[model samples]
Target: MLDKIYVIDTNVLLQDPKAIYSFQHNEVIIPAVVLEEVDSKKRYMDEVGRNARHVSKLIDSMRGKGKLHEGVALENGGMLRVELNHRSFQYLQDKFVEKTNDNRIIAVALNLLLEEQTKENGRQVILVSKDALVRVKADALGIPAEDFLSDRVVEFNQIYTGYQERFVSSEVLTGFYKNNGIPIETLQCGILYPNQYVILKDTLRKSVSAVGKVDRSRSFLKKCAFDNEHVWGITARNVQQRMALDLLLRRDISLVTMVGKAGTGKTLLAMAAGLMQTEDLNNYKKLLIARPIVPVGKDIGYLPGEKDEKLKPWMQPIYDNLEYLFNVKKSAELDKILAGISSIQVEALTYIRGRSLPEQYIVIDEAQNLTKHEVKTILTRVGEGSKIVMLGDPKQIDHPYLDEYNNGLTYVVEKFKDQQVSGHVKLEKGERSQLAQLAADIL
Candidate 1:
């Protein structure tokens, strides 16, 4: 078998600095233009900047092993090279601008393809890029391109939904309702994760059913404790919502992830549960609500105002849910009420990087916008007695580098599905309104 060569793109490294080591035993080519792009972004104070700096440090560290232009040995037994002589644009000059960074990167791959074809037994040279247009252009030039799949936890369709339906005997179903627990093996379901919910149905009677969750022991499927309970004047509108509430209210579970489409009540349910635990039950000291500031389309740039005033626009969705929970009609009145209580705090995820939160109910809304590293950093900040709920619709991600299967929310759901400290629920029904549901379905 011939070894393959993968040409790395700038956006791929910016999305994950460790991408250099992902292609095991394969020749990895980093076009010189990608380094130029990485250098331009290294001075900023964001995730991209950090990743850019990391990439530079990685390449620089390899200098001791060998010259990068000649090729250096990677830790994974792969060869890493910085292509310097492939700047020719003879193939793309007719179709694309010569000076653009993307075209320059594509030119390197095209030149490599031409060089490989001249050999008697040439290895396959493939372009790996996260950008669809780059891959499309590479295909037009007859170079194979693929998305970076190393960070993908699971395919979008195969992602864990936190629950599954199981068929059981009528006697088993009756025992589950009467005794509030049933042995997991009774249903012959194989290897259920701890905290995973199950819908039990009678074989003879389709309508007769019961909902239960796998206990921490993974030995029995126990009935949900808070399915019928109310939280901050809110009740679960569906089965998934009830499971979400149960997870949110559990003190044993440290992390809760809820994913759904728009109008599915992901944020509202999380906020309601946080408010109930923090205020009504007195289980936590404060309710910290936050979300990333990723916009749908073009950014409006910076706004001029105080921090809270500036955040009003980005944090309006959170405030809207709070207003509904508090039954407040005016924003000013809501501010006064929040200030008076002092326990409910609305914060931005930007400022949460360096702080340690203890005895707090932290709800991270729009978590789908966060990357895997960002989510890991946030989770590490959870001090003792803190419960963090990550809520987002994976399908509604606004982050350029994220998608339904690779975002932080989806990452956490898949990675922690089998852990006893975590619980997850994917809400299916939209509870917002008839019109809103229709829009989410059709649009």
Candidate 2:
């Protein structure tokens, strides 16, 4: 087999700076235009800027070993090279006359393909990109293209839901309830993770069932702690939500993740649990609600006012849920009430990077827009006595570099399933409204 050449796009590096080493033993080529684009974005104050600077330093360090135009040896037995030639867009002039950065990058791959075709046993050149249009344009120019998939931890359909259904005999089902908890060996099931929810059903009667969660030891199936109780003013409408509430209310579990679609009550229930713990139970000293400021469409740009006013647009959803929970009718009234209650605080995720949050109930909304590194930074900020809940719909990610399978929400759910200190729940039902549920399903 021939070692293929992978031409990476600027977005790929911006999404993950280590993508250059992810090609295994294959040759990796970065178009010169990618460096120029990366330099342009290095001044921003976000993950993209950090990645741009990191990748720039990596490539600059390679200069000591050899000229980038030629090649440099990688630790993974791969080769990294910056393609400086092929700036001419004459080949694609008739097809793509805009002379955009994408076209220039495609030109590099096209020229490499033509050059490699002359060899007796030629290496195939593949254009690797995160942008769909860039891949489409490469295909139009007769070059192979693919999306960078090394960062994706799991397939979308096969992602862990933290729950499963099991059919047991009537005697076992009765014993589970009779004993308050049953040994996991009685289920005779496959491997189960810690804190995983199990719905036990009677084989004779499908309607007769009971829900239990695997204990931290993974040796027993125990009943949920908050199965029928109400948190603040909210109640679980389904089995999954019940499991989520149990995890959220547990002071032992430091990290909780909730994945669901719009109108699924992920954020609302999380807020209720946070409020109940911070205000009602006094388990935590404060409730901090925040979300990423990723705009669904074009950003409205700068706003005039203080930090609170600047954050109102981004944190509106959190405020909406707070209003529903407090039963306030007007924004001014809500603000006044929130000010009186010193336990509740709402802010943007941007300000959370540098602070140590101890003895706080932190709720991160729209967490799917965050990258894995950003999530890691946030999780590390949790001090000695803090519980953080990350809530988001992986399928509804708004971040350009992320998708359903590779976002931070999905990453945490998959990576922390076995640990006793963490728990996860995937809410399927939309409890917001019938119309909202219909829209979520069809749209």
Q: Estimate, for each residue in 66-162, the C-alpha lDDT of model 2 and write its tens digit.
A: 8889888888989998988867776778998888899999999998898899999899999999999999999988999999999897975989989
Give the RMSD in angstroms, all C-alphas superposed, for model 2. Answer: 1.5
Give the TM-score comparing model 2 with the true structure, all chains together.
0.96
User: Which residue pairs in candidate 2 collide?
Assistant: none
CA RMSD of all predictions:
1.4, 1.5
Clashes of 2: 0
Q: What is the TM-score of each candidate against the true structure?
A: 0.97, 0.96
Off-target runs (Cα >4 Å) in candidate 2 are 225-228
Error of 1 at 299 (Å): 1.2
lDDT measured at residue 255 in model 1 versus the true structure, 0 to 100: 95
Per-residue error (Å), model 1, residue 110:
1.2
lDDT of 1 at 386: 99
